[model samples]
Target: MFQVALTGLLTGLALIIAVGAQNAFLLRQGIRGEQVLPIVLTCLLSDVVAITAGVFGLGIVLERWPSVLPVAQVLGGVYLIAFGVHAAMRAWRPGTLDAGDGTAMTTGRAIMLTLALTWLNPHFYLDAVLMLGTVANSFGADRWWFLAGTLVASVLWFFGLGFGARLLRGIFARPTAWRVLDSGIAVVMGTLGVGLLAH
Candidate 1:
């Protein structure tokens, strides 16, 4: 059990460390100090749902659904790539700062968008559901330990990201900082999309 817990913890944390669309958006909101908590909470909760689904046998089901998986991957990848390109373009030609005051990034729609961006991604499902599920199932009755570890990692990661990015709030006050961030997000999204397509 101890070993299983440790393994699950390490795997979960390592996977979350990747700079995906979800993480990028979280950082964006964090820098603006807008809707950070709700966004983070939604992210963590969605992970909980995904991981729990995995532990309870959703992974096996997903693995069998070959057609669905590829479709999801393509759709999610296209959306991410498009969104990234738009963000990059916006960064290159940013409008006035006052426009940000009424930006949609702080609304419920933004929260839902981020949640969908994370949860709807097939890569996320593959990692949290299929991969983690396979690991938990390996332990049989001890799968509970793996689930607990994963849950802990999810909670820790969301809080850390949500709060840690806050440290850069002042730096983000400058318009150029947002541009840099958008460009970085564009790169990460495009790379991930291409990688998914190749796979």
Candidate 2:
């Protein structure tokens, strides 16, 4: 069981460590030090739901209804492209991501955007629901332990990312850094969007 749990932790880390829509957005919020707690909690809870569902039975349902993934792909792809464009615009005119009252990137808006980035990505479902679920189910009697391991990984990651990003505050103090970050985000989002659409 311990070995299985370790495997789960490592595997979970492997999957979540990848740079994707959720991570990108979370990283930006983490750096800006704006609404970090709610955003981190949201990401963790969302992962909990997805991973638990996958470990239980959602993976099976997704497999049986293959059509669902394609639909998700189209939707996710479009959203990613739009987000990429938004990021590009920000990069072109990088500024402080003010967290002041009545600002554009309000807490509520940030949370909603985070939710969209999480759920709208087909890869999120594939990795959490289908892939992780399949692997956890393989653990048979120790599947729950694996679930525990994955949850732990998620906790460590979100908390670390949400808080740890402040370490880079020195570099990001300049608008140029923000511009570069946003530019990279734009490219990532646009490339992912195009890939999903082509798929």
Candidate 3:
């Protein structure tokens, strides 16, 4: 059980610790100190649900229903491109990175965006559902322990990222830093969007 749990934890971290739309948005919110708790909770809950679904056999459903993937791919690609464009605009004219900069997002809007970022990405489904599910199933009877480990990993990661981002507040105090960050986000999102479309 310990070995299976460790494997799940490490695998979960490996899949999640990547530069992507979800991480970028979370980091931005954390740095701005805007609805950080809600955002983090939303991410954590979403991951738990996704991971649970995968471990319980959503991956098999996905495999049997081939059309679902292409539909998700198209939707995810379009949404990512639109988001990337918005990020690019922000990069071009970054405002103050402070919470009181008159650019703070409303909690409702922030939550909606968080949901979109979490759900609309096909990669999220691939990683959280298909890949993780397949891997967890490989452990046979101990798969539940593996799933629990993944849940732990997800909890740690979202909390760490959402809270730890405050440490970078000093650097992000400058508009230039925001510009650079947004620009990087734009590139990553755009590239992923295009990749999904190409597939």
Candidate 4:
């Protein structure tokens, strides 16, 4: 059980730590100090629900439906590419990272955007549902242990990302820092997008 849990924990971290729309949005919110708690909670809860669904049985359905994964891949790749371009543009004209510098987004608006970002992306389904589920189910009776590990990973990552960003406040105070960060985001997104399409 411990070994299975460790596998799940590591796998979950590997998947979740990648560059994606959800993580990008979370980072932005964390840096801007805008609705951090709600956004983090939304992401964490969404992951939990998706991962649970996958581990229990949804993964089998996804695997059986051969066509669904490809379609999702195409859509996800396109969306990721577009998002990468947008991030590149932001990097080109980087902005200050002060709390007041960000657009005034209400908690409601933030939650709505969070939902859209989390659910609308096909990659979310691929990772949280198909991939994670299939992997978890492979553990047989110990799958629940794996699920628990993944749950821990999700909690740690969301909280770490949302709160840990505060530590970077000093570095992100400058426009150059924002540029570097956004540029890195752009590269990661674009590369991942291309990888998805290629696969």
lDDT, model 3? 0.87
Query: Clashes per prediction?
Result: 0, 0, 0, 0
Best by TM-score: 2
Error of 4 at 181 (Å): 1.4
The local lDDT score (0 to 100) that residue 65 gets in candidate 2 is 95
- Put down candidate 2 lDDT per residue, 1-199, tens digits, no spaces: 8999999999999999988988898888888887888889989999999999999989999999989999999999999999999999988876543322324467788789889899989999999999999999999989999999999999999999989988987788788888898899999999999999999
Model 3 Cα displacement at 143 (Å)? 0.8
RMSD of 2: 1.7
Per-candidate TM-scores read 0.90, 0.95, 0.94, 0.82
**Highest lDDT: which candidate?**
2
Is 2 or 4 the stronger prediction by TM-score?
Answer: 2
Write candidate 4's Cα lDDT for 1-199 as tens digits: 9999999999999999976778887887788777899999999999999999998898788778868878767876777787789879988876533445445878888888788667756778888998899999889999999999999999999999998887878877788888888888788778777877998
TM-score of 4: 0.82
Report the candidate with higher TM-score, 1 versus 3: 3
Ordered by lDDT, highest first, the candidates read: 2, 3, 4, 1
Superposition-based RMSD of candidate 1 using all C-alpha atoms, in angstroms: 2.1
Candidate 2: Cα lDDT at 180: 90
- For candidate 3, write residues 30-114 as lDDT tens digits: 8877788888889989999999999999999988986888888888888888999998998887664344442468878888888
In terms of lDDT, model 1 sits at 0.81
